[model samples]
Target: MNPNPLKILVLFYSQHGSTLNLARQIARGIESVPGCEAVLRTVPKVSAVCEAVESSVPEQGAPYAEADDLKHCAALALGSPTRFGNMAAAMKYFIDGTIPQWLGAELSGKPATVFTSSSSLHGGQESTLLSMMLPLLHHGMIISGIPFSESALGHTQSGGTPYGASHVAGHEGRAALTDEENELAFAQGKRLAELAVKLAA
Candidate 1:
């Protein structure tokens, strides 16, 4: 085994903290595995009219992600709040800048998974998850999703899905995750970390 812990990047963008909650749970799952560590990262918001500028460091929450983070991670768990059935623009923007990593295959063959938070039960959660997977696929990542073995997927009324872990944040986008949602997110993270270890071996 490698003496240093494998770093699984928990990268996310949360407008109102719902997605961040999911990221935290996923990190817990990653850390549950021996020789694994979770690194949380977020992207800054963008402006529609003009270039949005902010400090290099975020005022709160996880530090803003950089290309180096992607290059060194052993695995990845992406999360975002749904935006009209797709990933939020901020997340996409960060992904768009990873051409160098893509060219060098920095993330190729790594284990990856995704998560999302939506405002409604049917508000495009699955679509958002799928959208996030596109860039990962281009980077040659191996995507993983929750399986039927996860009992929460069969009965989750709020967010769990076979596609990925998710949370229905409700119309106000302030709802807390149900017990099932939390379990599924944690399971997803743990699964990804385990896969990373196995693949590294």
Candidate 2:
């Protein structure tokens, strides 16, 4: 057994806390596995028109993610809210800065997955999940999805999908996760952490 617990990074950008809720559920699943731990980290908001520098530390929620987090994780579970059918710019900005890690192949051979929260039924949750996967693919991580066997994927009314776990935050952006969304998110994280452990062995 690993003397130190394996770290599964839960990195995300949440605007209205909906995405954060999903992250927590994922973390819960990761922790369910013996000798596995979840490291929840978040990216900061960026300016639309110009470059803005956030403080070294975030005011609330998880600590700001550093390149080292990406370098050291046994696996990763990325989450974000939809931004016009794509991941938010803050996440994009953080990912774009990982050129060093990409060049070093820091994430290669690692298992990974994604999740999202959208404001509407058709708010492009799947697309946003795909958007996050594109970079993980480039980094050579093995990405997985919440398969239909999870049962929730076939019947979820809020935001669960085969692409990944998700939540419909409603227009107000404060809606709680439906039962299936929560279940799928937890399942996704558990699957990712288990895969990581097997790969390491």
What lDDT does the true structure give each of the candidates?
0.93, 0.90
Off by over 4 Å in 2: 48-53
List runs of model 1 lying over 4 Å from the truth.
1-3, 48-52
lDDT of 1 at 183: 98
Instruction: Tell me how far candidate 1 lies from the true structure as C-alpha RMSD in angstroms.
Output: 1.7
Clash count (model 2, backbone only): 0
**Which residue pairs in model 2 clash with each other?**
none
Clashes of each: 0, 0
My TM-score estimates for the predictions, one after another, are: 0.96, 0.95
Tens-digit lDDT string for candidate 2 (83-157): 899999989998999999999999999999999888899999988998899999999999999888898888888
1-201 per-residue lDDT for model 1 (tens digits): 548999999999998889999999999999999999999999988876435557778888899998889999999999999999999998999899999999999999999999999988999999999989999999999999999999989998899888899999887767578899999999999999999999999
